[model samples]
Target: MSKTEAAARLAVRKTYKLYIGGAFPRSESGRSYPVTSSKGEFLANASKASRKDARDAVSAARKAFGGWSGATAYNRGQILYRIAEMLEGRRAQFVAELAEAGTKKAGDVVDAAIDRLVWYAGWSDKITSVAGAANPVAGPYFNISSPEPTGVVAVIAPDEPLLGLVSVIAPVIVTGNTCVVVASERAPLPSITLAEVLATSDLPGGVVNVLTGSVKEIAPWLAAHMDVNAVDLTGVADEDLAITCEQAAAENLKRVLRPAAADWYADPGLKRMTAFLETKTVWHPTGV
Candidate 1:
């Protein structure tokens, strides 16, 4: 803007809030941290989620789990697809955020993220066909096993703000598990923006709660949280911190996915979705 244009109007800054239970709210601790761009330029202030915030997120996830998991797999797939459509509409915004966050091939990353969502959406209903099985028994019994969502999961997103976040989140939710996801600390703007998209989508509130803050401070609390059913340590780089979260998770026997070096651009298979799934087998008398 020119001098007169700049003088006439001031930019309205956006308040980057946490997405908990489908609403945007300030952190419970009332702390906000300056999120800087790739070159140390101020982007905006993101909520510095505290332990209390983490607990709230977990509660929200648990509350939504029953409804989300009970919904038909096809319904979940439709919601995920809707999210992808919304993200496509907001491509320019996501591209800008990724560029500011110093991601190379920003547009490509955004496209991959969108495609990843679509991929997982397609898998939602089909996963049962592939994972569920019928076993032949010598007796007159029909034995069948099927997969089910493991309940609320806590995810530490990888540092690739957009693609990595989508890569982890889509798999978890598409499989019917509600989740409390900690955005990548290095760059959370894109993740929060994605939360906005989610808010408008058909996805129910609390099905996917987003928290942006220090992973070290928030993750341990979630790991030890008795209500959380699983903890994904994909973004924890510190070995010691990962260990601490693992130990805490073990206390409740929460399903744990250890930190792994992942290529966000590569094809992510069924493993991520399977990690938090539990199998149930039933035996029925034939022709009873």
Candidate 2:
């Protein structure tokens, strides 16, 4: 076998761990399930994160929020571009995972994933200018409308493995929001690999965490977590599950992005940034 093929085979055996609070740890539940290729071939066993794990992820994200969200827009933009650089180096890995996940045209999935990252990287600097505004009122006081990141975000990444995952995650971090993401049920390997890539990128520890397991098993707990400022249920296709998430979110009035019925691959408009932004109106008076 070629050296590259042998290396890939060897790397596939390495047990994956959850990225929480900037450290790698086996699931607190100490459970793992067999991961299989889209062709039903055996891959590796992935850690199955439990409820306790979900709670811990929330804690980590909450702790990371202040510094991450408080960072200057220019710094945040640099960090996002750093992630894009890391992703470019790992294109082959993503391609392999998409192939195993049975995505048609694995190249297309990789290209789209890279393209999404590059697009988001560009948004990091300008989202503030694009989404935030200065307001004019009839009074003498100057009024400004600015956007701020919700404290902590929990995302159910797209089930498609690549595009779906990037769509939910890129926007969250671009605007300085930290996230705890639950990877796809049938396709967790790529998510875990992506976590490794992020770890190498300049992302602050706890800024982005990944869990691999049943979304049904983990998502409800996340939706109900009081510390989570918002929940994105974009990957949820089951109406019952979506409703359940919505009901749980009502506990705290957590900002939620419901499932999209249209094609996300289509050009995303302003909504992507607006959905996660909280408008803050500041007022100051000028006296003659």
Candidate 3:
């Protein structure tokens, strides 16, 4: 082919769709919105997820919860590490997307996100030992307390996009909880690509469902969903919005992690992992 022929060939653009139940699907509402680069250039059209899509994601998460929570911690760690490996392989793509989204230090951000995944992956098996312990009782009985996953989680991903999304998500699932994540509205492209990484990383379907579009439109339905066990409001910068979610969560006594300022680059420790964990104490008599 000549240079002119090559130049005349039309570019095939990628369609950014929502990742749900291990499959990429168009928004149920059949809506899409333009995602623009930092320079106000048209990048691509991303699925505009609606309430029905959020509900579908929740259903997917709930369905996958039992099997994921039952998987061996060691296995979970391996899967998370696999995600990091796939992400590292696609480093250039993520960097370019973040740059287009106006993320400064995009390369460092992507690196930090990868390192964070590895960090949480290493913690998968070790966390139980740290978060659980034996208790002293006044009887000849063995009493112990252990951490368990808090069922399905609904997450509002932070505006920081990639790093923050990875930060919140890695910990939640590493501990064996499944989640439906609301990708950053301002920069949904990276989240879509990350979903591709998740789908190919040996992670089970429905373990994570990524929703892209307006948070205001989709978050309330998640907050009020009876089947949702927990809600992370880390991405809600609006105080009133956070309060509304908290109030709605109260209806079912859903575990709510209220909005708070976080430095995505700083040490996250075990809080994010622990936030969605529930303690179950069991007692057994020693003597027969």
lDDT of 3 by residue, 1-288 (tens): 666554566778899999999999999899999989889999999999988999999999999999999999999999999999999999999999999999999999999999999999999899889999999999999999999999999999998879999999998999999999999998899999999999999999999999999998888889999999999999988888888898999999999987468999889978898999999999999996
- 1-288 per-residue lDDT for model 2 (tens digits): 676554434443778788898888899889999989978998888889999999999999988999999888778877877877887799888888889888888878778777887788788778778777888888889888888898789999878888778778888988989999999889898888888888998899999999998899889999999999899998787889989999999999999998566465776666766778899999999698
| RMSD list, candidates in order | 1.7, 3.4, 1.7
Residue-pair clashes per prediction, in order, are 0, 0, 0
Please give the lDDT score at residue 154 for candidate 2: 93
Which residues of candidate 3, in runs, are more than 4 Å off?
Answer: 1-9
Cα lDDT listed for each candidate: 0.93, 0.86, 0.94
Over 159-259, each residue of candidate 1 has an lDDT whose tens digit, in order, gives 99989999999989998999999999989888899999999999999999999999999899999999999999999999999999999999999999984
Candidate number that wins on lDDT, 1 or 2: 1
> Is 2 or 3 the stronger prediction by lDDT?
3
lDDT of 3 at 70: 99
How high is each candidate's TM-score? 0.97, 0.94, 0.97
Q: What's the CA error at residue 196 for candidate 2, in Å?
A: 0.6
